[model samples]
Target: MIYLPLLISITEVIIVTVPVLLTVAFVTVAERKTMASMQRRLGPNIVGYYGLMQAFADALKLLLKEYVSPTQANLVLFFLGPVITLIFSLLGFSVIPYGPGLAIWDFDLGILYMLAVSSLSTYGILLAGWSANSKYAFLGSLRSTAQLISYELILSSAILLVVLLSGSLSLTVNTEAQKAIWYIVPLLPIFIIFFIGSIAETNRAPFDLAEAAVIFVFFFLAEYASIVLICILTSILFLAGYLLNFTFIVSFIKETEPYLYAILVDSKHETILSDPIIEGMVYGLTLGLKTCIMIFVFIWARASFPRIRYDQLMSFCWTILLPLVIAFIILLPCVLFSFEIISSNIHLL
Candidate 1:
């Protein structure tokens, strides 16, 4: 019986990870295709079936590509940079509930865990830039440090709005609170702010100061990896993960029945199983669809926007995003209080 549950957990991880990895892989292809169409050119038509295999070909190329290191550079830190970034990026998946009760770990501090892990990716980027022993890499690292630090503040402030409204740090609870109306509707401003902040956080175009090569071909693989992580985190946070309906609740009940039965009896276990799995699946699908849509939007922004200058990027984060986020934080509580007062007076009417 214990083995069964363990197997299920492993299966869940594999199922979720495979699709997400495929999505990340194809997202690159889709971006190229979109950019090609925008420029009125055919993109990757020679590969296989509308260039669907191009991503695989690129992966093969990267795998075979020789990795050279500066002789004077610290080999340990240089190699550790990509490792750390990749690990941190994967860490976000721990707290992101993909379907009803589908997450590998569902800590109550899910939101905080996400923030902490996401922040670590920046350190990896900085380390890579400094250890490369090249001026371009060093400058790129400096730009990334400034950009991530400035935007993270705005992103955290926006996330705090959701935490405040939800009254819980658990991603599951956050999604539950959005059952009737997504926080996006009530907190549209914050949603927009978070969306843009995400773009900056991931160093996407219009905020991609870290990879401003003269030919625009300078690829920051570590930075791009971090961006994919941010995109997934965004979907998990605002888009509502697998708990779109009461599916998470139903799944929870089903999964915990053994422990409940061990304590109570067969009657209680049967009572829990009365909840239908079909309902849970429907809700889980709803949440999954929302997350996919959010991911698509991230891709859309990348396809549509142009990269901004480093100074302009800083100004946007500090002068624009910071002020707006601060305003929302200050105003949200007041608005909630006014709603309470108005509700009380309506009863007197």
Candidate 2:
């Protein structure tokens, strides 16, 4: 029985791990394809259909390449850095629900789980920077850590709005709270802050993504992974997770229309599923749509914007956004109180 349980656990892990590995690859292709369309050029046409296999090819070559460590660097930590980073990247996904029946673990503290796991990725970079003993790598790591830490507060503050409204730390609960209407409707400003904060966390703009090119593969992989994960995290926090409805200002999709193919939503536009297999697949796709769109915005921002002075990033986050979110937090209750959003709570406060 113990062996059987172990087998089942391994199977579950394989099921979750395969998709994440695949997603990391395809997001790169998607980023390239999107940027190419924006630039009016052919992105990747040779590998598979319109170059779908390009990511796979790139991954294979990267995997097969020789990994050379710096002679003066800490050998154990040098390799360990990337390992730690990749491990944390995969770890966070376990808490994210694909649908009602999916996810490896549906912990009640999912949001906290995500935040804690996400923050650890920085340690991996720091390890790599120190292990490599390169000045550029170390500086890049320091910038990465400082920038990510600074932005995480904004992320948390913005997310705290959702936590307050939802009354739960779990992403699943926060998502359910948005079933009737996404928090984005009432929390547009906070939503925007979350988006910008996410971008900053990934070290995309106002920060130097190119500066760490010397660290090359590991740092780069972690960077890309962080971007995509941030997108998914945003999809859960602001938009509804696999809800099949969005409150964004405008969209090509219909209000009731399913974002995924018919596999997920019935003809009548109902999203709840009676069939287990189809429910899981459809929910996965529905959630994928939101994550994909956000990832596109992330790639687009990278392509369109020029890097600003790093000091400006700190100034904007500290001087501008920090105060802004604090004021918003204070202002939210007052507006709610005046409008009768919180009657008993208002009096108690």
Candidate 3:
């Protein structure tokens, strides 16, 4: 009896983690293919069917590569850096609900937990660079630390708007709040801010000042894993997760609900439509589709834009994005109160 819960937890961890690791692997291939098409060049087509196996091959190669360490580096902290990054990046997924009751560790403060975990990932980068005992690596880490800190403010502010409207810090609650309407519909500017901040937060190109020391597979995995997780978070926060909540789709589904129920239900038993397994699977797919769309946008931005200089990056964050985000943060509440549109569930502290 004592081991039962432990076993279940371990199983849950596997279920949540394996797919993310797989997605992180293929995201690399997808980015390559996406960029190749954009540039009118062929990507890794020869690795497997349309290069689907390219990521696996690359993983194998990385695994087989010789490990090298800086002679003067603090070996403990050096190796610990990537491990810290990858663990914290993966930790954010535990609270992200894939569907109803599908999260590994759903809680009321899931959004806050994610933010905390993500913030910790920056420390790993800083440690990795500083521990490397190399001038260039240390400089790169410093740059990343500064960039992540700057953009995180804009991202957190944008999320606060969603939290205000939803009246909850739970990601699941945020998704449910959007069942009739997505936050993106009214908070488009905030969504834009959030999206750009996410790109910078993840060190994506055009704002990729933190992309260094990719020779370490752990670093590679951590980076891509963060990218995928961020995309999913974006979808859940702004796009309504699996529910979508589009008016036409909602009405269309409503019109077809009976037929879908009749077809999907087992006549001998109750409808599978309400079955947790079936509902979870369907919702999972819907959320996945949204996440994929967000991932494509990430890749698209990478392909479309060139990396900005560090000074320009800092200037844009402080001079442009910070001011705009601050204004939105200040004005959004007044607008909500003036319109009497704030959720009644929200309470002043």
Q: In model 2, where do residues sit more than 4 Å from their true spots?
A: 205-214, 245-273, 337-349
Collision count for each candidate, in order: 2, 0, 0
Residue 229 lDDT in model 1? Answer: 62
Best by TM-score: 3
Instruction: Give residue 223's lDDT in candidate 1 (0 to 100).
Output: 49
**Winner by lDDT between candidate 3 and candidate 2:** 3
Residue-level lDDT tens digits of model 3 in 1-349: 9899999999999988998999998999999999999999999999889999999999889888888999999999999998999999999999988887778888999999989999999998899999999998998899889999989888888899898899899999999999877889999999998999999999899987777543467877888999999999999999998784434553565487966545655567454546777777878988999999999999999999999889999999999988998898889989988999887777554
What are the per-residue Cα lDDT tens digits for candidate 1 across 93-160? Answer: 77776555757898898988888887887787788778878788788888888888888898889988
TM-score of model 1 relative to the true fold?
Answer: 0.79
- Candidate ranking (lDDT, best to worst): 3, 2, 1
Per-residue lDDT tens digits for candidate 2, residues 222-249, read 6677777788888888888887643341
List CA RMSD, all candidates. 8.9, 4.6, 2.7
Model 1 residue 239 distance off true place after TM-score fit, in angstroms:
3.7
> Lowest lDDT 10-mer window, candidate 3?
245-254
Worst 10 residues of 1 by lDDT: 213-222
